[model samples]
Target: MKIIAISGGSGSGKTTAAKQLQQFLGNDDCKILSQDNYYHDHSDKFSGDGSVNFDHPDAIDFHLMAQHLKLLSENKAVEVPIYDFVTHTRKKETIPFKPTKFIIVDGILILSQEILRPHFDFAIFIDIAEETRYSRRLKRDVEERGRHPEGVKIQFDSFVKPMHEMFVQPSRVFATHIAYDNNSLANLFEDLKKDFF
Candidate 1:
């Protein structure tokens, strides 16, 4: 099985890239493991004032995610955690993830974590302008995550931008490919298909 890590700043289209790759590879041949699901429960720490830095690597349980990846690499199935973004908590039930030909792991901090980095056979970092990222994040947060516009802006300014600079951007050096936009990602898909498939 090949493990692919897709890392980018929030709203940089990491999830979209992963979905496109999965579709290109076929659903039966690939499975996705989202790092967002591994975020540590922040219910008690939720202040809605951007005090909690969710963008930080410490905010996720990388050890558990690594273990799950290891298990999957060994052709073992695992129960992946289910996180509730609305409540900032983990759900009681988990989703069972089976091994496949390819595993696409998407997140802003996945490449930043040392424990998780070595597991990836291929790593991609998506790069985009701050303005584009912020705009996309704002729309997603307000529309999909039920976040207020004001709070999204505050959190982006306080945590996302700085953390992206500190953690996410530096991790770009580890990527085998860096995509700047949808067109780049599409070209990558063609290249990957030619090289791997």
Candidate 2:
């Protein structure tokens, strides 16, 4: 099995790229493991005072994700966690995930984590202007995650941008390919399909 890591700043279309690659490779041959699901539950700690740094690498359960990756590589089935964005916590139930020919690990911090890096056979980093990323994030948070526009802006300024610069951007050196947008990602996919599949 080949493990692909798709890392980028929030709203840089990491998930979309992963899904697109999965579709290109066929659903039966590829599966996606989202790093968002491995976020450490912060429901009890959230005070709504902008204290929580969700973009930080510390916010993720990298060890558990690494373990799951190892198990999957060994052809073992695993129960992936389900996270609730609104509550900022993980749900009690988990979704069972079986290994496939390819696994795409999607997240902003996946490439930043040393534990998870070795699991990836190939890595991709999506690059975009900060303004574009912020705009996309604002729309997605407000529309899909039930976040207020003002709150999203505040968090983007306080946590997301800084963390992206500190953690996410530096990790770009680890990527085998860097995609600027969906079109580039598609082109890269076409080039990689024969090599990987």
Candidate 3:
């Protein structure tokens, strides 16, 4: 496949699946693009504190993302933005991103916009229970992402959780594949090879 999208609500295991698929598909043949990389620029507008409402689709620069995808689809080089969530802004410099065969785009709101729909050959959704997602998010943010547990919990309660029902959950219906609490990357990897290779 030229491009595949791995999408779901935040902390729903989309990252894990994208990584597994990339490794299985091979680094030379696979490229992963996170929609998180396209987060809206708030440096000039909002305070450096990332006080902007990030849960909304308007909070991302989908136009830039589309341009990057068009470049890859045309077999050209593109620079992907590096986004720092802790700082909640993109860096000044972008790094080169070129793919040989497959491109895997992963994030929460990737598939929600129709502007991105025509770019994907296939789309997969990683889904988990609210309790599991919340728990996993709490741990990952606290440990890996350097986020405060209490802050994460508060965001979940006030924004993340409600937005899932408002936006994320409905997008699941459009997915070609739906994975729920299933960590069987090996089986999924092998199955994908049969389907795509």
Candidate 4:
């Protein structure tokens, strides 16, 4: 199996890129695991004013995610956790994930973690301007995540931007390729299809 990581700051197009890759490679052949699903269950509030730091690397259960990735790499099946952003907790059940020809793990912190970094055969960092990222993030949070605009803006200003600078942006150095635009990301996938297939 070919394991790839698509990582970037929130709303920097990492999830979109992963979905595009899955479409390009075919869903039967490509599988995606999102790091968001591994968020540690917390009863405390996750708002901008809350004490919990969701942007931090400690927010996810990396060890479990790493184990799941390893199993997928070895053609083994695993139960991937299901996290609820609304309730800030993990679901009682997990989604069964089977092995596939391509495993695409997308997350902001995937490349930042030393343990997870070595698991990826290829790494992609979606590079976007902070303004664009913030704009996209604001829309996504408000529309998809049911977040208030004011809270989203406060979080972006407080944690998201700073964490991106501290962890996500720095992780770019570890990526095999950097995608600055959607076209480039598509081209990269086309090139990989030729190389892998």
Candidate 5:
């Protein structure tokens, strides 16, 4: 199995890029695992102040994710967790998944960790301007995550941008490809075909 990772800052189009690639690779041959699903359940520790630093790598159960990835690579089935973005916690249920010809892991911080980085055969970083990313994030958060616009802006300024600069941005050096914008996905698709096919 070939493991591919799509990593970028929040709202930088990682999911969009990953879905495009997955479609190109064919649904039957590719299995997608999102790092978002591995978010540690912090609902209990939730403060009314809204100071949760979710963008930090510490928020993820990387050890479990890496273990599951290894198991999948060995042709073993593993149970993947389900996370609730609104509640900021994991659900009790899990879905069983098996390895396939292509494994696409999508998340902002997948490439930021030393252990997870080495497991990827191909890594992509979607680069976007901060203003554009912030705009996209604002829309998505308000629409999907039930967040207020002002709260989104505050969180972005406080945690998201800092975490990206500290961990996500530097991790770009490890990516095999850098996509400047979503328009570049077609070219990236061809490049991936050449590399993987």
Candidate 6:
């Protein structure tokens, strides 16, 4: 089995590509794990001041996530944490997953660290313009994620935007393949089909 790491900034459409790749490979043939699922669940510790800095690497339990990936690579069944973005907590349920031919890991900082970087058999980078990313982030956060437009801007300015340069953007240097265009559902499937075979 192969592990394909998809890395990009928020709103880069890497998640769409990962989903399409999974569908093309079929449910039994591939699995996807997202880094957001590793977000630190700190419902009790936070002060409700809206100052949580989630863009940092310390905001995740990468050690636990790395162990799970090792188990999956060994063909062992593992239960994954179901994270709730709205509540900033992991759900009570754990989802079982096993990869058949491949496991697609999608995230903003997949290659940002050397420890997590070497695990991927293939690394794919999704590139987009800053203007495009801001536009997509504004639309998606408000319409889908239920975040306020003003809050999004604030968060982006304070952390998210700067972190791209500090961490995420530099990680692109590690990618084996770089995609400039935002791959559509159909096109993403086709691209996966072309590569997997």
Candidate 1 per-residue lDDT over residues 5-46, each given as its tens digit: 999899899999999999999999999999999988999998
What TM-score would candidate 2 get against the native? 0.97
Model 5 TM-score, all chains together:
0.96
Per-residue C-alpha lDDT of model 3 across residues 1-197, encoded as one tens digit per residue: 47898888888888888988898889888988989889876656544222456677888899899888888899988998888766666898898987568999988887887888789888888778898889988898788767677777777887788778888889888787777756554666677788886
Model 4 TM: 0.96
Per-model C-alpha lDDT, please? 0.92, 0.92, 0.81, 0.89, 0.90, 0.80
In candidate 3 the C-alpha lDDT for residue 39 amounts to 89
Against the hidden reference, what TM-scores do the models get? Answer: 0.97, 0.97, 0.90, 0.96, 0.96, 0.89
| Error at 20, model 3, angstroms | 0.6
lDDT of 6 by residue, 13-69 (tens): 888888877877887888899888887796765443336667778888788788888
Q: By the lDDT metric, which is better: model 2 or model 5?
A: 2
1 or 6: which has the higher TM-score?
1
> Model 4 — which ten-residue stretch has the worst lDDT?
43-52
Of 5 and 6, the candidate ranking higher by lDDT: 5
85-192 per-residue lDDT for model 2 (tens digits): 888889999999999999999999999988989999999999989999999999998899888887888889999999999999999999999999778998999988
Model 6 TM-score is 0.89
Off by over 4 Å in 3: 43-51, 183-187
| Per-candidate alpha-carbon RMSD to the true structure | 0.9, 1.1, 2.2, 1.3, 1.2, 2.4
lDDT of 3 at 53: 60
The sequence of per-residue lDDT tens digits that candidate 5 reaches over residues 42-147 is: 8987653447888999999999999999999899999999988788879999999988999999999999888887789999999898898899998998898888
Model 5 stretches astray by more than 4 angstroms:
47-49
Model 2 residue 29 CA deviation (Å) reads 0.9
